[model samples]
Target: MSKTILYARVSTADQTLDHQKAQAEASGFVIDEVVADHGVSGVSTTLRERLEGKRLYDKLRHGDTLVVRWVDRLGRNYQDVTDTIRHFMRQGVVIKTVVNGMTFDGATQDPMREAVRDALIAFMAATAQAQAEATKEAQRAGIKAAKHAGGKYRGKKPSFSRNTFQVVKEQLDIGQGASAIAKLTGISRQAVLRIRKDPSLADEALKRWGE
Candidate 1:
């Protein structure tokens, strides 16, 4: 029997494995299994690179359903996302998303349907990549501004390390909640909020403390 597996890349504590499972269930997916990659950066790692993500390749079979929060969860960039989806579709796996309840079925023989499905996949994949790039650019700009200011802005050093800030920024880029990021990084929610509010300032603080 084919099973419906819910896959999630949970980088934060708030969105735990259980939370993801519940989210899928609330979205009407009768998930038989849950596959999650914890503390994984969706913007930096390809689906195949993730420990749990790789398992999907081996665990999934023809006719099984693979459910994700969105298409972005399947890859790190436009090309990667599109390629991964196409690969899975070719293998006869039906891909579904909790958001928008989108479905991509490879079982169809209709040319029109296939074309539409492929187009949609391309659009969503590109959009995901675009969003990631925009977020990255914003953070880069912030860092640049902070560095140029050169000790002009002085305050208490941020509670997060450079690594933690990068992780938080990545998760933010992928649209993860601040509270969730705070919980995962073991920092205050306000700190996460502050980072979100002004990433450049956060970077400057990190630089001041040599974190």
Candidate 2:
């Protein structure tokens, strides 16, 4: 009996991994182990390159079953996703999807069928990559247009509320390290360190205690 591994990737802090896991469980997968990569941008980081994502390359054995919500969860573009899939498939790993019980395995006997499968994988991966590229290009164009037109209405604004900055400071005083403070407050560790670096910043953080 082969082991089953569940991989759930949430690119942004706003996205929840629970939902993906729930979907996999609801579909009858035991989920022996879970590998999650958080705050990792799917566009630049492929399924193999991520911090936890890289673990799959080493952990998955020949008969292990790898599960994901969708192909896009593997990569933002088609090539990244395809390469990741084909590499694992060649290693005798079977990839199972929660979205549609789709399975990709190297056990198929027909060469022509394999070729067709490979081609289809290529097409899908390419399409995913193209879509990511197009989205980036569109953002660039939008930014350029905004630069000429005062750029205010392009996308969502950063939610750097004053309250968040305050929580960051208090957490520091409570003996929370920079990483913990960032994780708890949803701010970056770099930002927390910056505050600790300057006494002036401490003063600012202290002020935030009441508000």
Candidate 3:
């Protein structure tokens, strides 16, 4: 029988595999199994380089469905994401995302459909990579700014942690409401609005406060 497996990557202490699993279930996915990689950097490590990620390649059979929170969970960058998705699609595995409920099926034989699917995959992969790069750049800039300010910087500490901010940002990116993101991340709605307004500033605040 074909199975539906949810893959989660937890890169920080604030991120939990259980939370990801819960998110998947809440998104209406009836997952048969959960596979995860802890403390893995999605931007720095390829999927195959991860221990559990490798298991995904071996355990998943044709006709099985692979579910992720986002396309970023599948690979390290645009190229890696596209390649990994194509590899799985070639094996007849259907890839789905919990965020937008995107479904990519390789079982179709129509040329036009295939072209559209391929284009969508490329766009999503590129978007994921671009977001990752932008976040990294923001972090670096934050660190540099903090170092330059040195002891003179006395910025107010952020009400949210790095992980909480990330969660809020992800939800906001998917068009979630500020109140919803605040409830989900256990922060104030105002804080979520602040982050939504200027994510880079929020990130810099965390870094400046040494969070």
Candidates' lDDT values, in order? 0.83, 0.76, 0.85
* TM-score, predicted candidate 3 vs. hidden true structure: 0.71
Model 3 alpha-carbon drift over 4 Å, by segment: 152-211
Judging by TM-score, tell me the better candidate of 1 and 2: 2
| C-alpha RMSD in Å of predicted model 3 compared with the true structure | 10.3
RMSD of 1: 8.5
Model 2 scores a TM of 0.72
lDDT of 1 by residue, 95-145 (tens): 999888999978889999989999999999999888878977887777777
Colliding pairs, model 2: 77-128, 77-129, 78-125, 78-129
Model 2 C-alpha lDDT per residue in residues 1-211, reported as the tens digit of each score = 6799988777643445767889999999999899987657778777777899999999998999999987767888666788899899999999988876877888998999999878877776676677778888998888788788874433533233467766776777788887777778775554566666674744544454432
lDDT of 3 by residue, 1-211 (tens): 9999999887653455667788889998899999987657888899999989989899899999999988988865998899999999999999999889999988989999999999999999999889888988887777679779784443557879998988888899899997678678887666776787789998888987887
lDDT of 3 at 189: 62
TM-score of each candidate structure, all chains considered together: 0.70, 0.72, 0.71
From the highest TM-score down, the ranking of the candidates is: 2, 3, 1
* Pairs that clash in candidate 1: none
TM-score: the better of candidates 2 and 3:
2
